[model samples]
Target: MNINDIKMVGIDQNTPIEIRERVSFGKEIKKALLKFKETYNAEVVILSTCHRSEIYVYSENIALKTIKDFFIEYFKVTEDELGQYLYILTGVDAVKHIFRVACGLESMVVGEDQILGQVKNAISISQENFASGKILNKLFRDAITLGKKVRTETGIKDLALSISYIAVKFISDEFKDLNDKKAFVIGTGEMGQIAIKNLISKGTKVYVSNRTHSKAVDLKKIIPEIEVVPYDDKYVQIARSDIVISATDAPHYTIDYEKFIKVYKGKKICMVDIALPRDIDPKIGEIEGVSIYTLDDLKKTADENKKKRIGFINVIEKIIESAVNNFVNWFKTLAIEPQIKNINKFADVISEIEFERVINKLSNIDERDKKNIEIALKRVAKKMSDLMIKHIKNDIINKKYEEVAIDFIDENGGNI
Candidate 1:
């Protein structure tokens, strides 16, 4: 397939969290991948994270509108609901977008390292479901390599900024110091763990909880100083804490408005919900003496990080550009290889026919002479095949006869 067949349609940090939440695959991502595969018969990879819900596909016939329609039907949302939030990218633009995303250049917290792993996980999930094919597999593999290269060659990840780090940093801004504060963190996943560790680094008395008690116990084992609260008893610990951060992959809200109100003591508290589906209900933000933050709120800290690290952005962009070019060059060969093979096959056929016609007239020739003539004809065919391939490649690189070169190959050689 051509590079233009590589397409991506989704919403990112630009979309409001309310709308973003509606489109997130969340725990249903694998199911979504299977559905896309069944419906469109395309290579699909869904990258659903706290900041984005991107569906990437590689197919020759699936139109952008088809994916848009599938998104609307599957998510059960109308065009009005999506409302200018979705982005559509294809060809080189799609390649550049993914590379940027993997390198953390497109993240809300620019150059945040977590997105690299998230991208890897998205592709891994797609592979596990058997939804990804050669094109998407190679695209994602290149993206991951570029991600690692950017981090290694540049100082983009030097600050080690992440959504979790920024969420805690937001709260840290409100308080003079975290050393005297107690934090109750829900979920022990990557984001949850990052939040917990960042809080501990600030010398905050951290109480961790997870739906799986063993995970929370494991976390506490890693940091013996931190306290572990039972998942059901989280509300008790949350009430006692000055700060509460919920960052779980649960589909439903972990701290809904109804349940949180029961344990509400009217004491001033700050809650941060960093999960994509959102662990804390938005309505809880309306409570008296309560302040809540979601992924959107971290934009402020992200902006500050961007300003401090603006210089690294240029370096990152150069690296992304180089990576994009390399991937595109490799991708071009997918389309060209079949044409080259056809030309070589055509050459072989022509050489055999001409050799037979001439050999018939040279019946008196020795077996050695026949063999030498056969070798000469084969060498001539190989030379002609190599010459045509070189010219076609040059034309593709120049973009001068790229369209016509394929047509030429199709007409002169493909059928033969």
Candidate 2:
């Protein structure tokens, strides 16, 4: 019944990109959950995104060592490597962290809307795999509700500063105008779509490419002006474009330095890599005419956007507090319900035994008198049960239900 039994272990934007990339589970989330459960016998939910990887667990006994071992083996990280990057949170802090994450307060791009869906998706995947229990299910459901509440109630989401949007903004700031810019976007995922939209909005001619050509073609259908370049010819488009935004979930680098350097025609280009495993090679930034920006580089604009929305942060915090308090209160009730049931059962058992003893002792009395005596005794027992339950309910409201229930049960009889 201790709320502190809930625990979370993971890393976020605070860690270096190299560590983040290594720790990130990406598409292997379901497999990871199964491994975690099989290894630790605990209910778990994992949230992995471009900027963060988090695991939430509910268990009777949490073994940090076991959890750490799972991460070490799964991510192929050494014990020391895991220790440096992993952050552990427990009890109410774990709950608060989840709510904050769902609200996008913990994002690199603060108030970004993508994380909310990511959080929901994490819980959904956990549920689909039966890796979530009552505690995690309730926690995630409330967190999602709180996320929606924060967005609808505040202006925090007014100018949503997503990674994709930040990349485009970074590019926009560098150039006087994007009207004449030829931009090539790699990968047609969510981030790619967002980048394309922002680029098109700024009147830039966009060339889109994805590993799956159909996806790029689909994006072209949405924005008729965009040209869907074949995946193989992406470098040719990259060589020609003034701006490049790469946001793909590819395991390896989509744009390699060796190949790109060979194809370079000395045209100055601004490149932004927004993918997790990183879509572009770091060495490409060394090229004379190429200025490459990774997700870390987008922090400057993200920070500026964060500063603009700092005033509304207090409002969101209050909303999260209220939501968390509500969830904790409900969880407390869940903890106390079992004790309440036990108390009621004890009352019934005691009442029946006492009534039987009195009736047996007065066996010589008339049948009518016996009936009257039994009715009176039953009333007294019912009143006593009602009073005890009233006190228990009061203790629950005051958040002293556990301590008070223990004392009451001990005072009555250890058996109860």
Compare the candidates by lDDT and give the number of the best one: 1
For model 2, the superposed segments whose C-alpha errors exceed 4 Å read 161-308, 340-394, 397-416
TM per prediction: 0.59, 0.58
lDDT string for model 1 (1-416, tens) is 57899999999988987898789888899999998899889999999886899999999999999988888888999999888988899999999999999998888667766788889999999999999999899999999999998888776665445788888877887786999799999988878877876687678999988999999997775567689889999888878889999988999999978888988899889999898888888998999888999888786666666675777788888888988888887777667888888999999999999999889987689999998999999999999889988888877866778889999999898987
Model 1, residue 63: displacement in angstroms? Answer: 1.8
Candidate 1 lowest-lDDT run of ten? 153-162
lDDT (10s digit) by residue, model 2, range 106-156: 976566677888899999999999999999999999999988888887857
**Candidate 2 residue 90 C-alpha distance from true site, Å:** 0.6
TM-score, prediction 2:
0.58
> Model 1 reaches what TM-score against the true structure?
0.59
